[model samples]
Target: MQFVQQIPGLLLLVTLLCCDSIRAQDSSNMANMTSMMANATNMTANATSPTNVTNATMVESPMPAQMPMNMTQPQQQQPSIWTTEELVTDLSLPGAPNATLDVRYNDSLQVTLGNKLTPLQASTAPTVCLRNVSVGCEPPFALLMVDPDATSRQNPQFRSWLHWIVVNVNSTEKLHEGDQAVPYNGPAPPKGSGPHRYVFLLYCQRGRRLQGSELAPEKRKNFNLAEFVNKTELGPPLAGNFFFAENP
Candidate 1:
């Protein structure tokens, strides 16, 4: 009996040891699986993150396919600033006239308004001509000479002193070639009056003739250029030129 009891105890001890071993093996296997999962998760995070392998630096993510991306810089369009039309407006010479218009005082002296000229040289009437008046498409025109800087530059008591006025002019003739509504008078800026602007404006009319001869003002002081042009029904100016003169 004693021997049989001892055999049972021995079998029981062996069974307990086997159970302990199996529990330890299961714990070890669970730990290995957990480690493997952690490593896999770390690899996935590195792949998805915005980091380059070479520099290990963070980088910006690329734009999505659905998003609009501007790859090129915007180009600015430049406006035209150096044309005859722009220059006219800049100089406050607004009117309508022949497109192919040019003015010259003498063969070598071209008239570009606002240029400087000696008082003595600009005293006489300048020569005016047309580009293609011989073609016969030219309309009747007129000319007016005024001094905006009359009396003095700082104080223009006599704002616009009319120097000359003429009508029935065409490209073929000089300013003196036209009918002398007002006889030409040279610039006579007073001493210490500073430089004066002598403006010569050309105007257009529908018909080639004036009904009756328009008498010009005897005195050239305080002449209203706008009023004269409008009252006579002269169309907008087509071309104009001017010069500056100072008393010697």
Candidate 2:
């Protein structure tokens, strides 16, 4: 009888132990679920944060958008202005090379191609200068002033009427400082000659001394520029530029 009573007590004790184990398991599962929910809430908050949104936007933006507002965009370069040498080349003068001829007159007034000048204004000797040359440089050259539209524009019988001639002109020196073979006689176009082209030619002296007496100033008409260059032994012209003038 005592043994049977002891069995019932043992059975009760086993049942209570099982209940305690089940309660412990339920408490552990609840704690794990709470932890998971907290983690999920933190993740949701981070996704909606302003700083995170800004970072994401920056990552998706183009390169130009990231630049400062005041920054300037790259600009294309423009074409350059015409130089003196380039203007001479456009004339298509035979044997005349291109050079920088800066012509000024009447108190530094710039003279360029197609520049209209009254015979009176042109009569005054103009100051001529050379630029874009080396320092302490002196290269001997010859200068000639001629009218391609002499006598008449339609039929130029006396084409290239020599007006002025200067020899031994150095690139560093002015035209007046050199040897003036023929004195400057500004444009004297005939009344009906229309607008005449007074071409100025520059030639290299090639280290030879030239005398003003060698040229016959009296015979200025019908002068062929190429023939004169050959006779004088002056090599092909270094450069040439010209201006326009008409009878007053």
Candidate 3:
């Protein structure tokens, strides 16, 4: 009886040992399967997520069509006042007569004359003659004459008149008898008269003589008109400025 009881006990112990071994083997297999599943999930996530490289490149690059053009800055312009070159070019009128005179003081003055006159005329009595003078009288320091053709005729009531006349001019100064003066003469178009040219002339000379002395002694003695110009080097009898307008 005792031997049989011992055999049963031994068989029970062997069975328990076999069950423990099987349980351990099953736990190891489960752990291996779980690790394999985690690896597979990581690979799937990597494939689905957006790549950092391509996205970064897209953000940095600009579309060629959207680019702007490089532009240059604008330049500033100069004012319209007369320049020495322009003044000289305008003063050299074609067919203008050359007078016997020397320009002193400023070359700019010569340029001023050149820019203001029309073509020259050949008459001893300049196309624009000095008024109230006789044969022996000397030319004023600066004289100007204008042809009506060069003036504006915008207003009928406001006629163009002599603009400037510089007196006591140096006789050494010469002008193309028909050139215009600073104080140019305007066309005294008769009422209802057709348009007429006003001549302008410029002269330069030395010393101021009374308008009286500038005239022929015989003429000065005969005409008792008030002196048009004084001995001072002020200017001509009329205002020394020019403008254009139509006869009223």
- Listed in order, each prediction's TM-score against the native is 0.60, 0.58, 0.22
**Of 1 and 3, which scores higher on TM-score?**
1
Per-residue error for 11 in candidate 3, Å, reads 16
lDDT of 3 by residue, 1-248 (tens): 89997998999999999999999999999999999999999988776678844454445566567545776577786532223223212323222323312222222222223323222221112222333333243555545433322223333232223334444454322332222223322234445443433323343343434352233223211121112223334232221112222243
Candidate 1 lDDT trough over 10 residues, lowest sum: 79-88
lDDT of 1 by residue, 163-243 (tens): 887788754456447788888898889987888877777767666665325648757887766677667877566656667
lDDT top scorer? 2
Ranking by lDDT: 2, 1, 3
Candidate 2: C-alpha lDDT: 0.70
**Model 2, 1-248: lDDT tens per residue?**
99997998999999999999999999999999999999999999999999888787554545564667799879986432223423323333453345546666685666675577777777866777666753232467778877767785666788768888888886544754588888888888898668887767667777776887777556787877767777888765555556777764
Report, for every candidate in turn, its global Cα lDDT versus the true structure: 0.68, 0.70, 0.37
Residue 160 lDDT, candidate 3, scale 0-100: 25
Model 2 lDDT, residue 187, Cα: 82
- Between candidates 2 and 3, the one scoring higher on TM-score is 2
